[model samples]
Target: MKKKIYNILSVCLFALLVSACYDDEGNYDYHEISTINTEGLEKSYTKTSYQDVLHLEPTVTATGGESDFEYLWTLNLTKGSGTTSNKIEIILDTIGTDRVLDFPVNIKQGFYDLTFRVTNKSNKLETYQVMSLSVVTKFSEGFYLLKDMGNSTDVDLHASDNSLVDNIFLKMDGEHMPDAPVSLGLDPGYCFVDETTAEYVITKALTVCTEKDVRISNIEDMSTIYTHSNMFLGGEAPEEKPYYVWRNAYGVGYISDKGAYFSTQASLWDLLGTGKFGFPAMVNDDEETKPNRNGVFASTCFYYLDELKGRFLFLDYNGSLHTYSDLDENNEEKPNKPNGITHHLKFFGKNYMDKKSTGYALFEDENTAGKHYIYQLVLGMDPFNPIEKVTEVATSSKLNGANLFAVNELTAKVMYFVNDNQLYMYDLVQNTEELLRPTDMATGEEITYISNRYWSGSDNADKNFDYLVFATRKDGKYKVYLYEILGGKPYGKPVRVLEGEGKVVKMHYVDPSMSMVSYSYFPNSF
Candidate 1:
């Protein structure tokens, strides 16, 4: 009886299906939507200057309802949104509505995601191609001017393109600096392979310092990474004022209260304090260990002359401090030397081209107090040996009142000095001097700063000696002048003159090496 009921139900279902097939009155049709195949779009576009046009012309192919289509080009910034690798797009601008783009890239210099979209108006179908774009500017590199505005200090950029960005700290940080600017430290990490551990290392960054505050800013984007309290490993800077801050191939170094401190090749990334600095560079200033007004740095160490002891001291790359002996065992001038003591030696960053422990040193006579002498220095490769050369320059009329000095890196023999309003070039080879003064002094203007710094990070080899840089102040107004060096001397007048609102304390050429990336400590991260 169950088998008979099951057969009856199956027959009823089959009859219903047959009846439905015969009663069908519907039509099925197929349509082809527009398709777009875009070509000539590179995977990425990078490193274009700000003044150039975005000349992008791509070959686009379409089919089906291609005749009726609309085009749109949009730029968006893709940002990571959570812990995952997923990204969220923030549309920056709708650049164009045409198939070809001849638009000027007027956006800020940075990385952006570009999207080209094409839609078939008839079918409402859309197709897109995305690309990565990187924008840069010529204005990113050039001279940096530290301007002293009476009560405060700030930075300005005289860009490579001859454009000036005034008050860069305020423009980028959205406010004034924590304190007045003190000095600029640029370390373009010169990567080296450590022989002992067979490890490669590069710790690079730019340090902008003030009297009481230190700010570490990223050179890549000119962004503030760590400032003031966060920059110090101790959480707070030393109560004593910092006289100098500098970065070189080895590490970041600074001088505070006559003592120099170094942070070995440590970076801001990976962890804190690795790039942070601590401890006063080794100094036994019996009389308060008073270091000189300024000091110089080697590739592996920073050097200073103690005003109290009148000896040379060095802080190595490992954060260890040492003093190179400048005396004989007898405590008297060595037979091979005269006035062998470094008591009156003052440093002016003279080791612009030394790959070892050698360069020029300036000496002052204790007898003729205000006078100075230029000497050759080779403190020896090791601490045990003292082999050096000193230039015993007599106190002459030309050398008198020579307060400012700038060594010419090209010749290594030309020294530019200023006396009152007069500028003189002293040739060390011939021991002769030439007066470079304008000779038409109306109001007395005093010269303030002069330097011939070596730009090790620059591809231009002669960057150090190519210009004669100096500053002058009179009646509260300041002028920073740069003269092109021809032969071994500057032009009759400055090729470029930058007027400052207050005193122009220092000027430096910002080079490519100063910019440090997020250099990974892990070898695999490279």
Candidate 2:
């Protein structure tokens, strides 16, 4: 009986080995996947905006296939000049059997070919499905505003097309932000990080809000936000929150309470580790409450205020941080660095010129009389070298403080400044100052914020005339005044007084396509 059992076991082992060796043939026990089919495959899609989320979650049906299979959905966008095209790949991981797939359809306005490939594990055969997608502009004409509403901040949408939805953020998410009831700090700004991505920074505990193709589409989903608690190199704690956030080719940077920090992306927490650098804030010994955390300048090189040192400093991409004078002093050819005027600046006007010939407006120095000097900083042919041009523009009386609203790049000559009760236009070309308009400060009527419509044509009635929008408040209502600029001066009284809601504190003209204005308001007056 033992001998008979041994003979049977040996025969079975030999059969198993033969089957394993012949598994590559069609004789395998597992069912082979011959073909794959998907039902309701969308052949074409009409995308109006980058925010349009395409419902990719489609039922994938397969026939004549084994139980173990893999599904791959791929999308390729082709862009370039003529025959030379660059392919942007979008791939979803492999999955088993029939499943639903979901993804955003946020891409630049263009035509793309999408492909779906499925493979059977048993046979290693692939079945491909092809489709086409068409993306066009829908809400491309509008301006989006991030505003402070006393208790919290909210995003408002002003659309040129009446069909587009208004107050998009509240409508889409039913909340001000993903983190509701979060207040914002000074001067929140937005920048296009890439062809499809836009980053919005409100500076509440270092939260960066990201949006994809926000312009021409209704936000069908919730926004993704990133917050950084500690952002320091060598694992050190963050010293201060950013006051102003700006972006360029180098990356995003912030003028923080502690100084200046630059990051490759919105998540500042990992900035230092991911090839980022920072400049320390000027040390405060006398203990001043409010440092001039106003404006910032950035291009290939960055220039920012050093409050404690009471001067301006620039950081180059080569990781070199020095003052304009430091560059001169280092050069042996120029021995004594010019030191006649004090190197002090309270704020910088919004830079609106080309990087090669960029011009910046600087508030010269703070004084007891509250009288401040206005200086136009012009970059020479060599961007690293700069020349300071002092403007005779002076404030009427001792104006305590003012906000640099907008810079006119059309003529590269004028800028708008908003104080408590007046709006001043400083002509850099002629070095002249003019108070364009005034408000009654007694009845809570004061100019709170201003924004420039630097866009051309679009919805603007006069293509030649640029606009300066002023946010003035009285009682409980907010009024917006759009002043047309003829030549380089405010034409007259505001051409239009727009109806504004809430306590308008901040405003920005976001998009040129819609000629829409975005402004932030507070529930209560400041």
For candidate 1, the lDDT comes to: 0.59
Candidates in order have lDDT scores of: 0.59, 0.45
Which residue runs does candidate 2 get wrong by more than 4 Å?
A: 1-75, 78-88, 92-141, 162-222, 230-237, 265-292, 317-320, 326-344, 350-367, 380-385, 391-405, 437-445, 455-466, 481-484, 490-500, 508-526
Using lDDT, give the best candidate's number. 1
Tens-place lDDT digits, model 2, residues 1-526: 9999999999999999999888464555885446656677777666564666666655444576355667776665422211112222233333223445555655554445666777767678777777766554543334334444554445544544533233445665575433222212211122222224432222111122222111112221214332333234444545444454434223445445566555553222212113223444322323222234554343444555556655555544333445555244234333222223444555565444433444554554544445565555543223233544454445553223665455655445676776656677766666666776433222356666665654443344553336666676666456666676676565666755554454554443323221001111110000
Badly placed stretches (over 4 Å) of model 1 are 1-55, 60-139, 169-182, 189-206, 219-224, 266-274, 283-290, 325-342, 351-358, 384-387, 437-445, 453-465, 474-476, 512-526
lDDT of 1 by residue, 1-526 (tens): 9999999999999999999889656776766656877788898775544467786888776776256668999886433211011122244699999988976876555456888998878778788999877665543467777766655667777776677777777787676665566677655442223336654433234566677776665444566656657656767666776666665324566776557766665332321134566666554433245556566655455666666666666666565666654455555454333223544755454433333434456677777776766656553335532435556665575765677766666435677787775788777667788887432222367777776533443434654335677788887777777776665666566666776555676776654323332111100000
Candidate 2 residue-wise lDDT at 389: 48
The collision pairs in model 2 are 49-216, 57-101, 139-216, 147-520
Best by TM-score: 1
Global fold similarity of model 2 (TM-score): 0.55
